[model samples]
Target: MKTRYTYGGDEHVYVEVDDEMSLDAFFIGLSLSRLVREANIPGVTEICPANASFEVRFDPDVIAPDEMMARIKELEGEAQAQEKRLDTRIIEIPVFYEDPWTHETLMRFRERHQDPSGTDLDYAARINGYDSVAAFIEAHHSQPWFVSMVGFVSGLPFLYQLVEREKQLEVPKYLRPRTDTPKLTVGYGGCFSCIYSVRGAGGYQMFGITPMPIFDPEQKISYLKDFMVFFRPGDIVKWKPIDRAEYDAITKQVEEGTYAPKIAEVEFDLDAFNKDMTGFNAKLMEALNDA
Candidate 1:
């Protein structure tokens, strides 16, 4: 599984990996795990992790585009082949929509939280002790799941996916957007990836969060697009409510990057949220289906 090519003026190759999966897979694989293995490229100074993609920058004059492109194509070919043939696991996250599309939901959400809000809810959660993710996933079966945008943010991962789009949120850009839109935030339903929403200003619709974290500094990782997405490039998503135990377990998995919850405590009304949001509109899924 080792294939090498140059990308952005540096050499990037895919190496056959054991069955180990994590956020690092996205940041050119090993995001920061390769820090000690591969010395930082000269002139690149430091490469920071972001919510969009793991990156590196070298002196333009020293590294030519032709060389970079050549390497990129080589690595891209290899990575593409190794990716899962299908993203069959579209973790269904249950959301109450808070209130409803009419008045209550939007009103309450807008009451304290503004329209363009981030997933910085007031909750401090952490977990530890799990031998493998398999053990943990098994324990949480039938639990409620969530969907979020899987992006590398400052080395940690987070999810922010929208189940629906709203017209009121579609404000156009002042000037024409060109080559570098600065990769604001990324969201997905199937393979549809778009950079929208951020701490600053922007004009694009955003909704809902994923059941997983988009980043994890401790793990020094990132996630592959299909591996962390809600649906396959062709499958539809139907939001379903799950039990509180499952929600708590998976949430811990996302934040800690573990296969099981070791030493822990759970505190949240996940059951109520799931029950309230269980009767989600199945029709919305058709609109999202890539088929």
Candidate 2:
């Protein structure tokens, strides 16, 4: 893929991997960003990798903008030549679908929704060709999702469904941004799923809420003890739909500082996944289950 390099002011260099969003494009950008980080070019301050592009912040006094761009271009070429592999972790996040919290929240913002007559889950189900909400939920948790980017709020992960293009779930954002979204609410917009890390304004369609907290400033949770943020760009997420009882149980454990998210380490190969997505994903899930 051809990359477009541009300047984002005097201190930042922007690299666009592709004109549109795709798993292939995201992986390419990810590869380039990883290579850049590994290279540890002097004067480079920050490396921000997005869905289809990446940006680098640097001090021009230490390394000229032209030289920085050249180094990135070289790394991009190297990224393309190498086999795309990522050492990532698959984490199981339990969600309560159509939970009352998000249901009440969405209902409060009906005037801003595309379909106000029904809940967000119902609207999404109808548009996605699922006969019922249960089927839609089934489709959602059946396949693991890729953490394409981690932003929009600290530790909030933007996820891409790991399915063929035709099978991906797509949803439109709210007509207008909502003044409030419940914390930990699992939201979907434009084929990406995200968990609201904190209670704040949002536009994504609210599906459900997860009991596990992805962000904690106090770093109380065991998994989040090392860092307040729990997710990274390359992490894989598997959704396990749960009922209200289980949700409450997990919530209690979390409050007592006992819950730890289910996670398993695995390596992902883009070429192998492209050849047989089903088989590769199954193996990945098996590893998660075995863990």
Candidate 3:
């Protein structure tokens, strides 16, 4: 009745695990772990955790849709039977959407984003942290977004794909990319359909930003997709536009790291001891945080 399997390719498969861990637990429980272990096929990853939808990405060629969906159902039934509601709920984050033409405000002053692995945001929040992103998926993580890349472009962090289909939004080059167009100031291609994390040059018409910081350099758990953004691939996001005043106020607070959230924190922990023999390390802290 739950956990449906969707389409994908040999590179990966998308598996959705529902009613699993809470918003906070998987940060440490099972998100980053599986990623640490490379060279493993039929692996998994936690793309994002929305209100009732969690995503796990795998090689569709390797794991069939039925299996992926069945696993999600199995996990849900298991947790429900045990009367244990895993701390896996959607996170609320602030977003600011600006015109792609506003290249002046988009460039990043710094390079190399800080590692959000072990800090206050990561520690304070109840996440299932592991050595790599892969192991976390293998264990307490679910909801596979096949062929998705959890990354930061133009200073913003997101689990995205180089959408080849009719994009949710048109993306194009920034009208005026600064000397330092942040890799994290990520937006959908062509006209930048969806923009997130940090500010960047853009020309696409967009919705207003949410009232939360999408990326944090100082505190850990910066990958806001699961714990904060909680938005994964295939999760339908309805953009609600905000006024200029709201955008200004919210973006200012986020840039200054003084914004506060109005949602309650979630705490869910799961089996995170599963170790992967292969390991993968990222050398690109080049993605700056205080951009």
Off by over 4 Å in 1: 1-56, 83-94, 98-149, 152-291
Which candidate tops TM-score? 2
TM-score, candidate number 2: 0.92
Clashes of each: 33, 0, 93
lDDT per model vs. reference: 0.30, 0.93, 0.34
The order of the candidates by TM-score, greatest first, is 2, 3, 1
**Model with the higher TM-score, candidate 1 or 2:** 2
Better of 1 and 2 by lDDT: 2
The C-alpha stretches of model 3 lying farther than 4 A from their native spots are 1-148, 153-155, 158-167, 173-178, 182-186, 190-211, 220-238, 251-291
The lowest-lDDT stretch of 10 consecutive residues in candidate 3 is 277-286
Residue lDDT tens for model 3, 1-291: 244445554433343433432222223212322332232325444344322233556655666656654554444433333322233222233333343323233323112212223321122122334454234222211221111223334233233211222322222333433344332232333312344555544332222235554455544343342454433322212233344677678667756656644332232222221121011001001111111
Ranking by lDDT: 2, 3, 1
Q: What local lDDT does model 3 show for residue 216? A: 50
What is candidate 1's CA lDDT for residue 97? 17
Report the error of model 3 at residue 212, Å: 2.8
